[model samples]
Target: MRAILAPLWNNAYLLMTLTCLFWAGNSVIGRAARDLVPPVGLAFWRWVLAFTLLIGVAWPYLKRDREILLKQWRWVVALGALGVGAFNTLLYSGLQYTTAINALLMQSAQPPLIMLMAFFLFRDRTGPVQIVGVLLSLVGVLVIVAGGDIDVLIHLRLNPGDAIILGAMLLWVLYSVLLRFRPPVHPLSFLAATFGIAILFITPFYVMELMAGRRIVPVAESFATIAYVGIFPSLLAYAFFNRGVELLGPGRAGVFLNLMPVFGSLLAIALLGERFTTAHAVGIGLIGIGLLLTRKA
Candidate 1:
């Protein structure tokens, strides 16, 4: 098991790419299920299921790392609140009103945001090459967001949903930046602790959502959405992203998020029968070049 997993665990690029793939799928699915699953309710259950699935495997690591975890409880709580609790809930909430295109456009801001936060908060410096790379990727994102037409951006309007998604993006940026300070513990131990904290943090909001008459519709599609979100985006994506950040640093790791829109576009074509266009090819090419440049930096 160690031998098979070690190679993957060491491959930061692969981890981050997979992370974006899962997250792209997450955005698509979240949008599709918005009517079926309420935001806070979806978030609450997503963490609940992730925690349930993780705790069993993490128990031994938790026991072994109890002292370290307890010592670093503050970081655990902060990360849980920002990354698992607020970000995801707000994302789902925002998706309720926004088109997936708008959401992906919002997501494109993450790399620069993460870079800026890292610089301001920690004095982390970004090189010129990285800056150029980020700009290229941003253009790629714009091409995709605008559906190959620049005029679409001119006519784009921001609504409450866009603001909500921006707020979520900011929270995730903070989470990614602060992950540098995470305690030295087994990945499983950290994830388990944070997952538990996320559940605790989200409980009241979930209850309030219930009180407000925003209940999840009980249906097969809702269950399937919950199940997929619980396992892929919640469990695997977070783990892979955290490790990728650990290996590559927040600035570099964040550049990979540019791929989310790229993958999201392809996923749409494959799943929704959307047409593949020249813009997608050009945008994907630019994003690929940007990633390679960032990697070199």
Candidate 2:
């Protein structure tokens, strides 16, 4: 399969899809384990877990290619900050006050932000179709976020968590764009470094939260879910996303942002027993159309 799909296989699609699914599960898990993980502490511990895994798996690479990574340590650390640190921080923080609806809906905005950022930062081109696609996906996101009523937004009832999620959305776009200029480190080593450094940077928060009597415990069916988040979403998700951009270019992979809401909404209902609603379907369709419009030619 690897040999046959080399020309057409989309690591980006797989990465984006897995990310959406993992994130969807996280949403459900967040609601269930809200008390256990807390907000900032949860984000802090995810990096702690991811950091330990990366160090164990890629420590050799770090030692072997120390010089190469050192040559670009600045960018690597910066990427780690935005990609792993700020984004996850914003996500977990937002999850504290927001519903899964806001979390997923805000994430849907990443494509346009990435596209527009890439165009401005790197002089990439954007066409009419891209605009339409962005607008379309946006409608679905808004519908979903507003719970399909639109009136909710008008009533000024949006939660603070929603804004935090939006911050996370922007962080992802910034991270995606940065992937285009990634250092010359192996993917594993890069992920390890990114997660590791992010953990280092975020440890104080974790300790502070811990000192405040916050403890990490399981909210999912098993403690293994935390392990899964570390292995798959944190490690594998980062690897595939980076690989996708490396192989397909960031411009093309940005379209995958649209799929998040589709998968997130479904998983939320299944894993978390979240109620399905007509508004969700409408939002999904609109986001679908918008995402299609943004696909690369």
Candidate 3:
């Protein structure tokens, strides 16, 4: 793996950074999309479209590896639940009740929390430096989620948005560990299958909502939002992320995703008119330092 990845790390780094930015933009999209589409409807259709694209693009491989994918059906379903079903669903749902800044801060906790969960769940070894770095990054995450207020964190009264974001974190952690464990048949083929199968999983919930008559009323603007989610975050971002994981390996690639919150916060300010404050600056510095310390030296 090292020999294969060494030559591609540079390109992977660039691609992953772009993935982070895309995800940050996704947050903005979700926020802007509120009220225009039902959260569940947006989540459901994005995957439906993504599934279509992946099927077309990976049709040859999908046919070739049909047996292997069939054999790994459980993993595919598991990954689909965590990666597509849970993550995107929670994101859209949270955006309904929370500010984009709140959502981004909560999502930012993924890297450190994933490391901590891996250590405990899998008995992975952790050094003092790593533990400290994780803790430091976690503190930053807490600060951001608390809206730059230590008092709110101290009170332990986290906002509902934070809870939703935490759910997204847990979903991804499970996805990460699952990827490490019963990996799909082939990396690229697996990614394609994982995404291609998402629509099937999300369809039931969408159907229920539609039966209840709460589906987003289709309009030109609504179509644009769904199309944006399909192409940008679901298709392009996943492609970038998979290429990064293939090139840099999952560990390094995971750490690079830390940039998502930073980018999200900045974009929130620029696009959403969120105020930039001292606490945000401090949190950024701490998370940056933590990532630097955790990086392979």
Candidates' TM-scores? 0.99, 0.85, 0.83
In candidate 3, the residue pairs with backbone N, CA or C atoms under 3 Å apart (3 or more residues apart, or in different chains) clash, namely: none
Please report, in order, the local distance difference test score of every candidate based on alpha carbons: 0.94, 0.73, 0.72
The parts of candidate 3 lying over 4 Å away from their true place are: 1-12, 142-148, 152-156, 159-164, 182-186, 243-253
lDDT of 1 by residue, 123-171 (tens): 9999999999999999999998788997898988888999999999999
Ranking by lDDT: 1, 2, 3
Judge candidate 2 at residue 100 and give its lDDT: 65
- Candidate 2 lands at a TM-score of 0.85
lDDT at position 91, candidate 1: 95
Candidate 1 residue spans exceeding 4 A from truth:
none
Where does model 2 exceed 4 Å of error? 1-10, 217-222, 274-278
Could you tally the backbone clashes for each prediction? 0, 1, 0
Candidate 1: global Cα-lDDT?
0.94
Instruction: Give Cα distance to truth, residue 129, candidate 2, Å.
Output: 1.5
Model 1 TM-score? Answer: 0.99
